[model samples]
Target: MRIEVNGTPRDIAAATVADALSELGWGEARVATALNGDFLPAASRPMQALRDGDRLEVLAPMQGG
Candidate 1:
C-alpha cells in the first residue's frame, strides 16, 4: 500500500500503525505519529490503521537540552 509518510510517498505493507512503524525500522521509543493530521496517543498505537493518501507524520525526538 502507498501512503504519504511525513509528506513523502512510500510503499509499505502494514495492516496497523504499529506494523507501519516496524516496517519503517523505527522503535516505539524514538518516534511519534499523527495520522491524517490527528495526534495519536502512544497507547493507541496498536489500534491505528493507515489508509491510502493518509498523511502519517513521524516526529522524532530531538536531544538538546
Candidate 2:
C-alpha cells in the first residue's frame, strides 16, 4: 500500500497505525503522529486505520534549549 507520510509519498506495509509502526520498526520513541492534520491520541494509535492518500506526520521530539 502507499500513502503520503508527512507530505512525502511512500509505500507502507501496514493497515493500522500500530502495524505501520511495527512494519517501520519504530518503537515508543517520542514520535508524534498526526493523521490527516488531526492529532491522534496515543490510545487510538493502536487501532487507527490508515487509508490511501491519508496524511501521516510522525515527528521526533525536540529536547534541549
Candidate 3:
C-alpha cells in the first residue's frame, strides 16, 4: 500500500499501524503517531487499521537543552 509518511510518500506491506511501525524500523522506538490527522495512542496502534493513501505522521521526542 502507498501512504504518506511525514509528508513523504512510502510504500509498505503492513496491515496495521503496529505492523507499519515494525516495517519502517520504528517498532522499538518511542514515538507519537497520527493517522489522517487523528492522534493514535500506543495501546491502540496494534488495532489501528491503515489504508491506502492514508497520511501517517511520526514524531519522536528530542531532548537537547
Model 1 Cα RMSD, 1 decimal? 1.3
- Give the total clashing residue pairs for model 2: 0
State each model's CA lDDT, in order. 0.83, 0.82, 0.97
Window of ten residues with lowest summed lDDT in model 3: 48-57
Ranking, TM-score, top scorer first: 3, 1, 2
Model 1, 14-43: lDDT tens digits are: 978888888888755567789999888777
lDDT of 1 at 48: 84
C-alpha RMSD (angstroms) for model 3: 0.5
Off by over 4 Å in 1: none
Best by lDDT: 3
Candidate 2: worst 10 consecutive residues by lDDT?
Answer: 21-30
Instruction: Judge candidate 1 at residue 16 and give its lDDT.
Output: 81
Model 2 per-residue lDDT at 1: 81
Off by over 4 Å in 3: none
TM-score of structure candidate 2: 0.85
Candidate 3: lDDT over CA atoms? 0.97
Can you write out model 3's per-residue Cα lDDT over 1-65, one digit (the tens) per residue? 99999999999999999999999999999999999999999999999999999999999999999
